[model samples]
Structure formats: C-alpha cells, structure tokens
Target: MTGDPLAPRAAPLHALPPLPPECPLPMPVQALGRGRIANPPRPTTPPNMAWRRFGVIGGVVLLTLVATYQMWWLLRGDGIDVLEGLLLVLFVALFAWIVQAFVGAIAGFVLLLQRRPLRMGMHADGPLPALSTSTALLVPIYNEDPARLMAGVQAMHESLDATGQLARFDVFVLSDSRRPEIQAAEAEAFVALRGRLGANARVHYRLRQDNHERKAGNIADWVRRWGGAWPQFLILDADSVMSGETLVRLAAAMERHEDVALIQTLPVIVNGNTLFARMQQFAGRVYGPVIAYGVAWWHGAESNYWGHNAMVRTRAFAGCAGLPELRGVKPFAGTVLSHDFVEAALMRRGGWALHMIPGLGGSYEEGPPSLTDMLVRDRRWCQGNLQHGAVLPARGLHWVSRWHLMIGIGHYFTAPMWAMLMIVGVSIPLLHAGFSWGHFSLEGFTPTAWWREQDGDRFIAVFVATMFMLLSPKLMGWLATVSDPAMRRGCGGALRVFVGMLLETLLAALMAPVTMWVQSRGVAEVLAGKDSGWEAQRRDDGVLPLRELVRLYGGLTLAGVVAAVAAWMVSPALLAWMSPVVLGLLLSIPIVALGASPAAGRWLRTRGIFLTPEECAPPPVLVRATELRSPGTNGN
Candidate 1:
C-alpha cells in the first residue's frame, strides 16, 4: 500500500523524500509502456481460455434442460400444459432488464449528444479577456512521493510561467499529513520549490494543525482564512497538473461568464509508469474522449464537478460551498468526505452554472498503478458517494440534477445488485422445476391455486431478457459519444470509436461481474463496519510482478470459478452471457499486469494501438530529452 500518515504507519515516510540532496537533477523517465498497437490483426482471445469460459455456458445450458424436463414433469403431474408457466419467470426478468437498459442507454445517449459545447471556445477569438484579477491555485497533499508531487506541481507552475501568466496565479501546498517526519520533509521541499520558483511563483505552504474532514476541511480552512479576499480559486490533488494556458483560459472563462460558478476541465491522465497505469492511461486517452464529450453535451450548464482539475469562483464557492455533515456516524455521517458533488449541486442551487470546458487543454491527473491500489481508492470513493445518496431524495434539487447526484451514490449500489443477479440467475431453474412459471413467492408462500396453475416453457424468454439486460447501456453510451468530434478523439476515428468501445465493452463485460463481486465484498465489509483504512495506492513505474497481479486479481478469478460452477449446476445458457464476466476476472490481473513492461509498451506503441488519452501527451521537454534521466515522483 502507498503511505498513509493516518494509518498504523507500517512504513514511516521521511519528512522529505529519501533522495539525497545531491541525488541527480531530473530522474530518468521511467520505463516506457507497451506502445498501442493499431488494428494489429484482431488477436484471438487464446483458445485454452475459451474452454474455461465455455464451461460456464455449458453448465447454464445443462441446467436449462434439466429445468425444462423438471417443469414438464411437474406440469404433467399437475394435469396442466406448462409452456407459459415455464417461460414466465424468464420473460419477467428479461422485461425488467431490457426496460432498464433502454431507459439507461437513451439517457446516456442524450448525454453524449450534447458534446458540441467544446466548439464554443474556438469562437471566443484572440487572447482570453486580459484578467487583472488574481486567483489562488490550491494543491492539497498527504503522503505522496514528494519529488514526483513537486515535479507535477512545478511542471504546472513552469507551464504557467512559460505562458507569461505567472502573475495571474499564486499556488499553495496544503498538507493534512500527521507523521511529523513527512511534515519536516514537506517543509524542506517547500523551501526548495520557493527558492526555485522565486517571485514568478508565489508558492506558499501550510500543514493543518487540525485535520477534520480530510480534504474538504482543509479547503474550508483556507477559505475562512483568506478566501474572503480572493475572487477565484483552483483546487488540485497531489498528483494533479494543468497547463498554464489552460489555467489562464479557465480563469478568463470564469471571469467572463458571470453566471458560471464553476468551470471544470476534462483532465488527461499521465505518469503511467506501470503496465496497469499504462493501460489506464491508454483507455482514458482513447475511449475517455467520447464519454467526456458526450457527457458535456447533455450536461450543458449542469456539469459534474470532479473536485480537482477544476477552477471555482471563490466568492461563489465560499458563500455556497459550506458542506453539511451527514446525519449519522462512520460511513453514513460526519463530514461529507466526498463533498465535490454536493458543492456542485449547491452552486447550481445558488443559480450558478457549473459547466465543463471540453476545449481546455493541459489538465492532467495520475491513476493508481495497480489493481489493488485502484480498488483501495474505489472503496473510499464508494463510501463518500454512497453518503451522497442518503440526502439526494429530499434535497430540493431538480430531478435531472438530483438524478445526476444519485449516479455517484448509485455506482457502489450497482455492484451489490449485480451480485444478486448472479444468485438470482442460479435460482431461476430451481423455481422452474417446482412452479412451472417464474412467479413471485408471496411472503415465502405460493398460493395453492398459483402452484396448481404451473405450466412450463422456459427457453425463449430467458434468452430475450438476457440480451436486453446486457446490451442497453453500451448502445446508449456508444450512440451518444460517436457523433461528437471532441468525444471522438478517445477513439481513433468514428469506426474506431465504435470498435474500440465494443472491445472495451467486451473487456468490461468480462470484468463487470468480477468487479461486482470484488466491489460487493468491499461494500459489504464496509457496511459491516470494516474500515478500508485510508491506504494510498502504489505506482508501478513500468515493472510489475506476476505474483502481485494474481494476488490483486485473485477474487475476480474466483468469481469466474464460482460462476462456472453455478452454471454447471444450474443452466449452461446462463453461463454464455456470464462468460464475459468470468473471462474478464480470470484475465484481469494479467491484462493489466503484463501490459506495462518496456517490451510490451514498445510493441504497442509501434502499432499505434495504445490505451493512453490523446491530450495526455507527455511534455515536450520530457519527450524530447532522454539524457535528463528520470521524471521525478511526488509524495501524495
């Protein structure tokens, strides 16, 4: 796990990085990733793996047959034709899934179709309204690789300086870290950066004497202290960075649009040294465009605020941004840890526009370098987002806006529901054998008349329902994003976008059930009062061990096994749809793990088939200079 000051402190982080004072200038760029391979003869999904996946389907089919026979026997014994009775359960589940898919997909499509907002910037013509106004850029940090953290922040500072916009912005380093040692390190680092930045960068540093709501409290304290004097502010995480130009543009946009309370940019992911990070970077680069673009279209004035990589009008945020503590304890109550969503809502409620500026560039963030790290992060986010769900119902917000708020909350909920689908899928056959039709049991009791009316025909309805339930959301996201050019950047082209999306979907499909299982377990543990313990994620820096991969993806593999076993016991056809999930889980670790070696990254890049985002192009100086050695790391 990455360093967590608040944890038991298994690894005590130094107040400063372990790097010796004279330790070389720039760290050598980490090992290059598997270069993306473009249209490299759509490779086969390995035949040996097929058998295991097929085994799941074969089980589902076998169960369906047994189920069919049992239904026939029961109905005949009851002296009734059983065809309709057998198909009813399958039909109902199918109908529910299809309806949900269609509605969900269409909503997503509409969201995607609204991607034209990016063009608004092109017409603004000339330099951004020259702003005399001053704003503060806030970078909140904990236990991160201070060197890398400094590098990222410095890069942004330099970019701003490079653009002659240095005078317009001042930067602050806010730390909530508890370990006295790391604090000592950060203080030293601040001194170094301050001297290096000089007057061009008015860098300031502060460690919270009291760490209350983690991040939000950190920001609130800043606001209470000096926000009253500033008109605008930019918030960033330890690993986040933005181009000076983008910062200036955002500041200008905020200045011009009096109604706009917040202007969030779609940040590209960078510093993906591990194979896992590489793949994530590639995926975000390729497929993320469409999603971001599509989302911007429908979002219009109602954009989501992804806490960091965004600029907020200071007066607006401070006045309207007070986050309410949730009503209970632990997970559900206390400070709204995930206060970004709520802040956006409150801004909108204040009649301020919270819009995403798709045209902006140079905004970037980093991903956890491994699956374990990713899940660790997700668990915390899940708790924060779930807490949002509790108050959304009666929050006096617009239905569209409220629904948007709920999506964050709903994300964790979906995992558990998905797990239930697996259990329910297993039971469908047993229900068929006894009841003829798939009907609800009333209070765990079926009326005698309902039982007697059973007649069985189970195959067709199950097939239709399965198809509808699975296909809806993808089709919607696809249709929504493909039409927008901004969104189109994520994919190679229109055709490429569709193909890539499907490929990604195929990958996600296989992974979904597995993730659901992992997430469900995480959610359950959390609900049962398990503390995730605020662990920081580890970065891969290009070399990853297979052992770590297996350990990380182990649960997913187990889920596949569990699914295969269930299908073999119940219904083979059921396994076919479930196959994607199984295959994904089984391959999860490897696909991510093995993909990051210098050898693989080189190979992928050779083919122009990659997973990194388009806008995340490595810095020009970094790209052009190889002798500089390393791209230093940050402490998060």
Candidate 2:
C-alpha cells in the first residue's frame, strides 16, 4: 500500500495523522476593553477619503430628510393615527436603508466611470508584481465535499506555479470536520493532491479535535501553531479561487505598505449552474462592482473583511485580532458567531489599516444553486449577524466599524420590518371593517374626505419616488456594464444585458416576499434564542422533490392565499396594492422549485438570458478548476 501510488487506500485515509507539534504563537483572547488602544498606531489613509465619507453620508441624510417630509405631508392631512404613525416610522427606517445604498451606488458609478484605482498605491492593471516575503494560503473548511475542495486547491496550486511565485507561498487546508469517514476522505484527497503535485509541493493539512468557535476557532488554532512562520496569510473559503497574479499582487502590496494590516478583494460569483445561481451570478457580476467600489472609496483604510479572499498581516492578526467570547446566552453568548466584523474592528482599534480593493480582478466564488439552499446559508448568517449586537458597543471601536456592525444587524431586521409594514398596511382596511375610509368621523382619525380627493396623485408620487430609489442601482449597473465594449460582449451584448436585468428584477420581486417571510421567521427565532447549527452547504443544482418543496413552502402559500382573499374582500384596490407581495407568497413553492431546476438554468443560458461575463468567457483559473472538479478526476 505504501509502495504504489495507485494502490487503494484503507480506513486510515479517513483520519488525519497525529496532530502536529505546536509552534506556539500567543494569540491572547482580547478583552472588549474601553477606548481605542491607548496610543494606537496611526496608518495613512487615502487623501480626500474623509470628503468621500462626508459626501456619501450627507447624501443619505439629505435624501432621507426630503423623502420623510413628503411621507409626513401625505399622512398629516388629519394628523397621524397609531397605525399611520407605525407605517410612517417603518417607512422612514427602511427608506433610510434604501437611500444609503442608492447614494453609495451613485458614488460607485462615478468611481467606475473614472477608470482609476479605488485604493491609493494599489496597481491592479499592470504587470504582475513579484513577491519578496513568504505568504500562507489558509483554507478553513468543515464537512465540505472532498472532491470539490481538493480540486480548487490543485487548480490554485497550478496557477501559482505558473506565476513563478510558488516558492514564496504555502497552502494550508485546515479541517474541522468531525465524521470519521469524511475525515478519511479529506486525508485521502490531500494525499492524492500532493502526489499529483510531486515532491516539491508545499501544501499541508491539519485537523482540529476541538471545534470551539467553528471557522473562527479553526483559524485561531492555525495562528497558534504555525502563524509565526509566515509574515502574511490569505484566508480563503472552501469555494474561493483566485488567480496566481491576484495572489502575488496582494502579498506584494502588504510588503510595500508596512502599516497596512489587511487587504480585501471583491470575489466575483462564478460557476453558476442553476437559474437562481445564474441570477445571483449575473447580479453580482453586473451590479456588485459599483457597490464594492462605492464602499471601498469611503471605507478607506478602515474597510471590513468578508471572511475570505482577504490577506492579513500575521503579526498584526496575532497581536490584535484575537476574538473574545461574547458574554451572553445561547446565540449571543460563547464564541462570537460573526467573527469577521469583530476581528476587523479589533484590528482597526489597534491602529492597523484595513483596505478593500475591488478593481483588482481574479477572485471568484460560487453562489447558492437555488433559493432554498441560499436560505439555509442565510439562516446561519442571520444568527451570526444578530449576535453582532453584543459586539457593537465594545469600547474603542471606530464609529465606521460600529456602522459596519450595525449594517450587519440591520440586514436581518429589515426583513421583519418589511413584513410588518405589509401586514400593518393590509390590516388597516380590515380594522375599519370595510374599505370605506369614510367609516369613521372621530377626532384623531385619518382624514377620509381629504384622502379621497388627493390620495391618487400623492400615492403615485410616493410610489414612483420609492421605486426610483430602490431600482436605480440596477439601472446604473446596467449602464456601466453596456458602456464597456468587452463586458457588453461578454454579457451577450447590450440588449441581452438589459433584458437580463429586467428578468432578474421580476424574479427578485416575486422572491422578495418569500425571503422577507423566511428571514422574518429566522430573525424571530434568533431573538428567541435559537441557534443555527453548522451544516454543509449545497453546492450543486439544488433541485428537490415535490414533497420536500411543499413541506418547505406550504404554509407560505396558504398565508398568501388567505391574505389575497382578505384583500379582495376589502377592495380590489387593496388587492392590487398588495399583489406583488401576495403573488410572491402564493407562488413560493413553484418559484422555489423552478429556481432549483438545472434545466431552467440551461434554458436561460441557451437563450443568452442571465448570461454573466464569467459564463460567456471564464477565466483561466476557473476553467482549470472546472476541469479538475469531477469526482474521479485528479486522482480523487
């Protein structure tokens, strides 16, 4: 068995070798102490970044003020009632979130049009830079597919070797898997990977007996054992893949900038094989850039980490980025679930600069193959983000860092807020016992006479304005895409790109209510102290059995039907107003089922609808990964 490389391996291949001896590098659990580190190291930030921040924040506030005033006037004809007051409150809160994104997209659109680097001193367009210091590529995974995981690593290994920088970097696969058979497969896969790469391969594998903090704990374990050997390390998700050139430039940037602690690259979604995945891939490919550029422009050196596709200074991370056990119960207590935001905050608190570079290409990852699969992942994310509430008030966090944490928390709350708004809006007609606004003439009641006279035009105006703020990002992203000849061609021309955007928008509208309902439930559960335990993600065409789909979405469909009947009974106008949300809920089962159909995805791809640039012309690294990703291929 030892002599022949092709010989079949036994059960020992299911388990990793004895744990490696510790090369201890102290990573003390940081206290959520008061105030920024005393005498924090001040790193240089981009010029005019403060102005950029002012412009973005100022724009959001101004737009919100104007919108809120109009809404107040619309409902103030007879003074706001309780339900009206609640509606107005939700509108302002949700509208502010929309306006912030709109303003940021505008900033990103301008930056993209300028065709300049997003971050200062970052050169992404020229020759690949050479690396002087050694870097480690750390991929932390748990209970993921062995074949797919090893294939991506092999592809990255080959890409780096082609860059002549293979000697300057090492790859580490840190596993937190608990199953004996799965661990065996992981070990066998790695053994095969090393054999295929020959004797000089620098890849290493380690398994943790304890899974304390899940992914965060796995990485901390690595930092304690071997982090001192490398000056910088790149964190990669199991699905993450980057070009050799992008990896080299990231390392070179760290070497050139001594004070910078981390650099984040925007990982574009690729390899989408289902309709839902394709929609996500197209959106991220077409619209994601502008958003990233906008955030990075204002975020400056105080940027955030997305957990992966980011390189961090080993010393800085070891010295300042240790995560503390959040003091709380169940969901919020124990290990911080959303560790990335807190880690970035702590690093920033220690005065280490963190930056996001979006223009530099080559970073890529896959999207959830279907909505059902996506929601499973989102459930965990929802819990993780909700847990950040406990971290938001930690002493000395930069205000921007606090904003980032708040954004994460709000991401989940907005769902319930949305659902509540719809529920309350529909409940108004029912509360009156009929559609007659003239039913009540008491003081502190809605002004039915005034509403009857001016409601049509005012309603139209508010609706139009809200839709504009919500959908302008898609328009801006499309315009930016079509303007670039190469991108336009890659996306199957300008007309197809336009059509794709419309199709994606329609599907998104149909799916939004379902998402809101599910996320609303998820938020409630998290608040009620429910934990989203770890589960392997579905990475393929997510088609499910009809029974399963019904089991998942039956209640939502029933709720939609009941809501529609109630709205139609009250007034056709109310039904019309609630159609978008009701229709989505009513059709949740079919919509989800269709979204998981590989055939539906293929049909769209064949028609040139929802075609992303990556689909039209995949990069070399992605092409290689696909070539090696099959089960029996690449010695797996």
Candidate 3:
C-alpha cells in the first residue's frame, strides 16, 4: 500500500516537526557531522583513561594479593587455631557493622526529630522578604544540552515570577567548559535564555576561561566578583531543579535560623528519560521519604549540604570553607575540589548550622544516564570525599564532626576492602586445610563483638542485611510518610504514593548492585591515585556497547566463580554473607553492560520492566490553590 503524501510520507523523522516551539531543545554539545562540535573541541588525549584502567587493574591485583597474603598469614600462624581466625573475621565484620549502624542511626534520628524547625511545603503566610542584600544562584555547566539548562533556568524564573521573588535571588551560570566553541555557544545561549525571561534581570551568566579547581573555582570566581554585595548564595548543579516557592522558603529558612549557614533539601530525582534514570527517579520517590525522614531526625543541625539543591550563607562559606591548597600533592592534593562537606564543616566551625530538610518540595536533581557515566563521576567524587582526610585533623575543631568527615572518607575506602573482605572471608573455611599455624606469629586480641564468627543461619541474615542496607529507610519512610497532618493534606492521599514507592523500591534493589559495584571500582581506583580527567558527560542518554562494558567491568567475573565455589566448598554461612558482593562482582560487567546497552534497555522495555521516572511524568502534586486559576499561574 502506498503511503499518503500529506498524512504519512510528508517528512523524514529528522525533518519532522519539532517537539514544540515553546520547548525547543538546545543543540547537543557533541560533534555530529564532522570535526565541528557545537561546543568546543574535546581533549584528544583521552584524559588518562588508560592510566585509570591500568591503575585499577594493578590496584585490584594488589588488593587481592594483600587479602590472600593476610589470609595466608592467618593460616601460617604457628600458635593459633581455626577458631581464633574465625573470631578475627567476625570481630572486624561486627565492628564495621556497629560503626555503620551508629553513624546511620544518628543520621536517621536527626532527620526524624526536626519537623517545625526544618519547615517545608508551601508557606501561605506570605512570601518572605528578600533580604536587602543580594545572593547569586550558581548553576555550573559542562557538556550538557544548553536547551535543558535554559529550560530549568526559565522554569525557576517562572516560579519566581509567580511568587514575585526574583529580586532577592540572582541566578548565575558558571561554565567550566574548555572548548572555545562551547564558550561562544554558551554566550549565545545566554542571550536566548535572557530573551525568554528578561524580567529575571537578576539572572546572570559568566563563563570561566580557566576552570582551575573545576566547580569549586567556578563559585570562588563569583564570590570574588560579587562577594562584596551578596551575603548568601544558592548552589545548583546542571541537573538540579527547584521550584520558586521552595527557593523562597529556603531563603526564609536561612533567615529564620541564624545558626544555619546552609540548608539542603535531599533532592528528589526528576526527568528520568532512560531506564537507568527512571529507575533512580522512581526509587528516590518510593523509598526516599523514610530514609530522609529518619536521617533528618538524627542529623538535626549536623546535616551536611550535598553541594546543590542547597542554600548557603556566603560570608560564612567564604570565611570557613576557604579551601586551603594541599602541600606536596599531585594526585590527591592540589585544590579542594569537593567542597560541599568541607564547606558544611567549615560553616559549622564558624558556628553556623548546616541542616537538611526532609520535606522540601519540588526540589529535584538528575542522575547519570549510564553506568560508565556514573563510574566516571564516582572517580571525581571519591577523590573529593577522600580529600576530606586532608582537612579532618585541622587545629581547634570539634573532633566529633571531624569523625563524621573521616567516616565518610572511610566510606569510599571501604568498597574495595569490603569486596576483598567478603571474598577472603568466605574462602577462609576452605583454606583451613592448608593451614600449618607455624609460618606467621599471631597477635591474638579478642574482638569487640564475637558472635559474627560463629556459624549460623546466614541466608536469612543476608536477606535482612540486603533490605536494611538498601531498602529499610525507604520502606520505613513509605510506612510513616503521611503521619503529618499538613503533609497528609498536601499530598492528597498516602496509599497511592505508597504503592508507587513499593514498586520504586523493588527496582532500586536490582539497580543497587550495579551502582555499588561501579562506585566500588571507582573508589578503589581513585584510592590508588587514578584520575578521571576532564571529559564532559553526555547529557542525553544513549546506548552502551557490549565491548565497552566488558572492558569496564570484566575483572569482576572472578567474583562469581569465587562466590560459587566458596558457597559449595566452604561454609554456607560464609557464602550467604559474601554472596551479594561476590555475585555482584561476578555480574559486574553484565550489569554495567546491560545498564549501558540500548539493546538491553529495549528488551527490558519490550518486556515492560523497570520504567524510569523521566519516561513517566511525576504524579501530580496535590497543591491547594484557591481561586481555580491564580494570576501567578497565568501565562505570559
């Protein structure tokens, strides 16, 4: 059958009518036709990616050898028995658990306790006064769709206009692009964005010619330019999206809490177009409430700001978070790159509170679209968080707070240790036959907790561990979400949302191993002094190649074998305990590969599984707006 010319054969897909004139997409920064990238030329050097691979392989090999050697050391012990060796493993595991539990519990309790002080949702009491002072909103951009960035800025500006709140808040575009083309394009895009919302005169854009400390320097430049005027600043990432109403509330909350130098909203993930993104978005929606609630209850004033979706008292950050240059440093030290935690600690040191509001609304952020993207991001973050080690022991500071920072540093370090520990830990039983107890001397000391070593029903224990580690707070939060009368009224009903959350949680579980493994490898590599280098993440989600996947996660294949053999030959209890880590390692490449693969994604979608949040719009917010259509809701 011939196609109708006007109806069907009218236009090619690429030449088809655009998504909408009102919602125009910016040109992707990647090169399309030829050598001409819409933005700038990428570094031809591949940014030490090979070094990263070599370092990771070397480090993993070294780690395995170290773990094997330690196990050997235990076996060769001249005077020790198997019982003592078992006791040692159990002791370390228990200690780690206790330390984790203690830290998590404190965070959860802090989140639960603060309701009134950490105000959220709409404030009908009238828009809070914009301080006579000025503050800038910094949105840092690398290689992203300029269209989406403009859209976000426009949305925020629209929200502000709706509430007449732009006067108090100034928005700034802080570009960290190296390519001259990107810089020029950003300038042009800035003009287009400004044209869309000229009333947002407070909105400003500046591109840094030299991105010294990456994002940290981007903000520092602003502080230097307009520091004398604005007393506070709000930092947002390229993906961070906040409602105008919420922004005002943040400014107001900052005003109300004299001690609060920074206020962070646990960003609600939004716009998950790809399955990976959607899964993350759904998970955050479903399981995030309780975990965030519990965390907020415990953290109280000690809540840390996660860089973006947060507001900061500028003067305090400048004075305290002034990143000191590292001494004798090439890989680990130079400039303070991850300044969020340090900045929070610095604010606290200056006697200012940094708090997280669990109930903040319309505050959104996006996640990486692929596993490779995530691991690449993790390399940078691991280094930054690990860099906290360089500052934790500074003079005349609260050791307890420093403990939190150090613990965070430990969090990244533990990935490799945990992976190795589980493998060696499970293999100990089989290795018992090889023991002579004479080659190495034993420094036998009783552990703080000893029951973990004794063989027990570990399958059930691991199931509990999985849920607790991944989904406890999510479930708890869902169960307890509608307890507040105001929130109950605000969200319309809890049941549907709760159901949405349950589905979100299950999907999150499947995705967790993928995230953990990637992060684990990233942390391990960064710890071994591997740099991720300067490459802009592709903003648009795209397909992943199998060859690339194998290259990225091939090493973890050994984990599956180790786990299977250990399960069959060694203790069932040990296997059960180590299964997730081991099996996770085993499936590492597959997970990374599948996560990155468009073909795999298509199959998943074809089977109707793990739908992402961006693919589906969020459930409409239950807002109680009087006068069916307020002037604020009217169009331009």
Candidate 4:
C-alpha cells in the first residue's frame, strides 16, 4: 500500500545523490577542499555602469545641496527657535530621500530612452539557451482558497506543457494552512487536479503539520526533504502566475550561469478589478519598468530576491540561505517576516551572484483590492523591514546587500518622518508669534525683496522644488510610455493615457495623507513592541461597507480636521498651504469607499481608461488562469 504523501519522512538533505556533472552544482567545502568554499570572484562593474552610478549620486548631491541651501536660507532669522532648527533638519533628511528617487527616475528615463537590453548577468548573446537541468516550482501557500490556488497551478502547469519542456519541471504545492476545513478543501482540490491531469502530471501537494517558520520554514522543509532532488527551484506566491516561455527562459538562464544564485523577473500587476487595484495595476504596468530597469542597472550582481516569481539555484539556496531565528521576542525578533531580502543577502555573502532582469516579462501578480487591505499588508512589511536593522551590520555582508536593507527600512520610515515634518512645520508659526506676515503675502510677490525676508521666498522655492522632485518620476514614466508606439497603443493611445495619468495622480495625492497616517501609526505600534501577526491576504475582497470604511478612516478624518483648524489658528496663509493635506484627510472615508468600488473600476475599463498592455492583449497564461473556473465551492 502507498503511504500517505503528507506524512513526514526521514530523508535528510545530505543523503540525496549528487547532481549530474552537466548541472554544475556548487559543492560544499567538505566535498571540494577544506571545510571552506572559497568565495567566488566578484564581477567588476563596467565603466559605463560606474559612470551611471556616479551620475545618479551626483544628481542626488546637487539636488540635496540646493534643498539644504534653501532650508538654511529660510531659517536664517534672528529669532529662530528650537522648533525651527528641528524642522530644518527634518526637511533636509526628507528632501534627501526625495532627491534620491528623483535621480533614480532620471536614470530610468535615460535607460528607457536608450532602449538597450537590461539583461545584466545573462550569458547568452543570441537565441535562448536550452535548459539542461531540472527545476522544482514551489508554491508555499497559507490559508488561501483551495480552488483559486489550484486554478493558477493548473494554468501554469498547462502552459508549461504547451512549451514541450514539461519534463524538465515539477510543480509542488507546499501548504502551511492550519484550518482543518481549508486543509480538506486543499486535499480535495489537489486530488481533483491530479485526476484531471492524469498520473503523468508532476503536480504534487503536501500539508505540513507544523508550520515552524511560516513560509520560509515551508520552503526550508522542502529543501531538506526534496530540494536535493533538483538543481534549481522557482519560488512563487499564492497569487503569482508566469508564462511557459518565461519559465523556460528563467530555467535556461540559471542553467547557463553557474555562478548566479538567483534571477528575479519583474512581476506586473494583473487582474485588479477594484478602482484602487486598477490604478495600481496601471501605474505598475506603466512606471514599474523604468524604475525596475534603473535599479537593475545599478544592482547587477548584488540584486535582491522578491520571494515569489523568481528562480534560484537549489544548491546555492540550500547552502547559504538557511535562516536562523533572530535573537529577540516577537515582531522585531524571531522568524524574519521579510525573508527574501535576507536570503538574497545571505546568498550574496556566500559569493553567489543575484540579479533582477527587468527586460523579461510574463510574470504577474495581483494588487490589494482596497486602501484598507493595502495598509494591512504594509503594516506587516513595516515590521519586517524595521527588523532588518539587526541584520544590516552582520559580518561578511556586502555593502550592496546592506544598502538593500536600508532602502527597505527607509521606505516605511519615510511615512513617519513626513508626518513629523508636517507636525513641526505647523507648530513653528504658533510657537513664534513674532514672525512677520508682511513678507508671507501670496499676492504681488517680489522675488528680490522676498528673499531678504529670510523665510517666505525660500520656503516657496523649497516647496516647488519638492513638488517637482516628487512628480518628475511619474512624468518620466509617462514619457517612456508615450515614446513607444506599442506601449502607447496598448495603454489606450496618447490621449487616454494622459487622462489616466492625471486621474491616477489626483487619486494618489488624495490617498497620500491617509496612507501617511496609517503608516505612521504602524511605525508607532511597532516601536511600542506590538507584533503584526500573520494573516491571510484578502485577494478578492471588493468594495468595503460604509461602516467599515468609516471605522478605518474616521480617526484620520478627525485628525485632518484638527490639524486644519490648528493651522488656521496659526495663520490664514498656513491654512491655505495645508489645504491639500486637510482636504485629503477630511474626505478620507468617501475617497477610500469610492476607490474600492469594483463598479468604478468596470466603468474605467469600459472606457479604456487606465488600460494596460496585458489587459489589452492578455497573455495566454493569464487568459488560461482567468478562464479556468475553481474546481470547488471554496473559490468564493
């Protein structure tokens, strides 16, 4: 009789047989020479690449200098208080962050304009190379809908079969679900899927009794039990979908590059039906490429892995990416929530090359359906990223790896920092009542005389510069889209794309205040030692109820009102300046509710507004994924 597949086995990782010679697996130190695998030689950055890096750095420096000069000039009054000084420092820090993104946007603009290939560490010069080794495709699922999960898996499996290279790959559904009902549903779905595909199908499913380290542990368990069976593995999230050709290419790339540990493809947002989701989908499809290419250009060998939709060398991952329980209690300690970045860092530390290929397509994932859902996800990410503060100073880590960690941390920290900056700015006028209003007049402004006032002219210049830096990236993304005829047509032509951009920008601005408050609260909660426990993502949660919306954003709206009133109490001019923030906050409930409406999204789709290339001409894999109905009632 056949034993239960879910039962744990005694198979140790070391007991697995060695890979064939053609696979070129990286051997452990004991198998090679001494108990130490020599560090692989690092690739030298090309002269042009070095210059690009320098150009980015130079641009940031120039912008930061201009901002700093303006800030200093603004605070040059005789009666400048401690609050004003603190505001200046915060402004500098915040402005520097803005400048960094602006510079990167410029780099992205240049790269897209050149239309050069973005394959950084790829070896093939002509046609795609043939894949020589086998790869295991892993989907580590939590308490997700069984039918939905199986549908995606089935679509991918069928796509791979269509490529005629299905023998080279095996698909595994590694479940970490704790609910009995969910587990039963998953088992039934798996059985039905396998039954339909026949016995020759390589699709397999396993449910772990003990979900030790969550997703990371789920993957690690596979590595210990079956990772040795394959030369490489592609990690995928529950919502992730990739085409057969893309999968074959990724496998071929890994097979050709022996030193490379990981290759991350750009996963475009797809299947978003809500207004918020559709906006995100459009922005991701349009602007994501430019930003991704810019980052890939700089992060050649030390690139990061984004957990899902990426392939990794099995041996490299097994040998180097075994995560240790960080020394702490909860949240900032214990199992790392954001394991992808740390895994990449560990792999790079072991001298394995990591790269992100932005030029490659066919990878797709879903976006959050609502603002509330997005914030929930962001809170967990905030904790995970902040936890990387401990890993940043680890011995033997490359500088680039540390930079990745810092960038992750900075992403969340910027929210709180901006909140603090706004708070300080509002209080400055109230604290120093002696400040003159004569120079702060909005009418008939004289630049030369206003500059002599030490605050008004400089503050206006700084505000304009800040806005420019903030919006320039979107403009670059727009330029990149319109410049390409195919892309332009795919996004509903120039006029529609332009209109869509304007709408997206307006919605983004409205949402910014709400997001800022949510994130700031998240940061505060983390600081207060609160842990963001793992929860299943609500992928198909359409529009939320009005009461729920009010509950989520009522406090934000109140805060905005209070802030606006406080600003008005300080000065009418300050109140006018703070109108955007105030309006966004006061209108938070309706904004969120309307944005979460699927009807609005459908209306936009009908009008061909915010149309993406993938939506216009759906890829076969995506079409299949959507067309295949869920096998069970669990889909809803």
Index of the highest-TM-score prediction: 2
TM-score of each: 0.71, 0.94, 0.71, 0.89
lDDT tens digits, residues 1-636, model 1?
Answer: 767777533222333222211211111111111111111111211124334324433444554554446544544553543444534344343344344334334434554465333433422225645677888899888776555566666767766776676887878788888877777667766666655666665677777888887888888877777675557899988767776777887787777666677888887777665445655675665445545654554465667899998989887787666776667556676777678887787666666667776546667777876555676788888777777765575344544457567777667866776565445544443455453335322222222223344432333443444565466555554555456565555444466556555655555565465567678887787677565655445554534577876776776677668867754444454455356666776677666555455566555444444433342345542332211224552221
Global local distance difference test of model 4: 0.81
Residue 400's C-alpha lDDT in candidate 2? 92
Each prediction's whole-model lDDT (CA): 0.60, 0.85, 0.57, 0.81
How many clashes in each candidate?
67, 2, 26, 0
Q: Is candidate 3 or candidate 4 better by TM-score?
A: 4
Q: Per-residue CA lDDT of candidate 3, range 108-185, in tens?
A: 544444544334332524545564555567898886655557666766766667777677777788788776666666
lDDT digits (tens) for residues 329-430 of candidate 2: 888788887789989999988888999999988999998999999999999999999989888888988889899999999999999998877666655535
Mark the regions of model 3 whose C-alpha exceeds 4 Å error after superposition. 1-132, 433-471, 481-524, 558-590, 596-636
Q: For this target, which candidate reaches the highest lDDT against the unseen true structure?
A: 2
Question: How far off is residue 362 in model 1, in Å?
Answer: 2.8
2 or 4, which is superior by TM-score?
Answer: 2
Q: How close is candidate 3 to the true structure, as a TM-score?
A: 0.71
Tell me, what's the RMSD of every candidate?
14.1, 3.7, 13.6, 6.3
Candidate 2's C-alpha runs over 4 A off are 1-7, 11-22, 35-44, 429-457
Q: Please identify which of the two predictions, 1 or 2, would achieve the higher TM-score against the true structure.
A: 2
Error of 2 at 411 (Å): 0.7
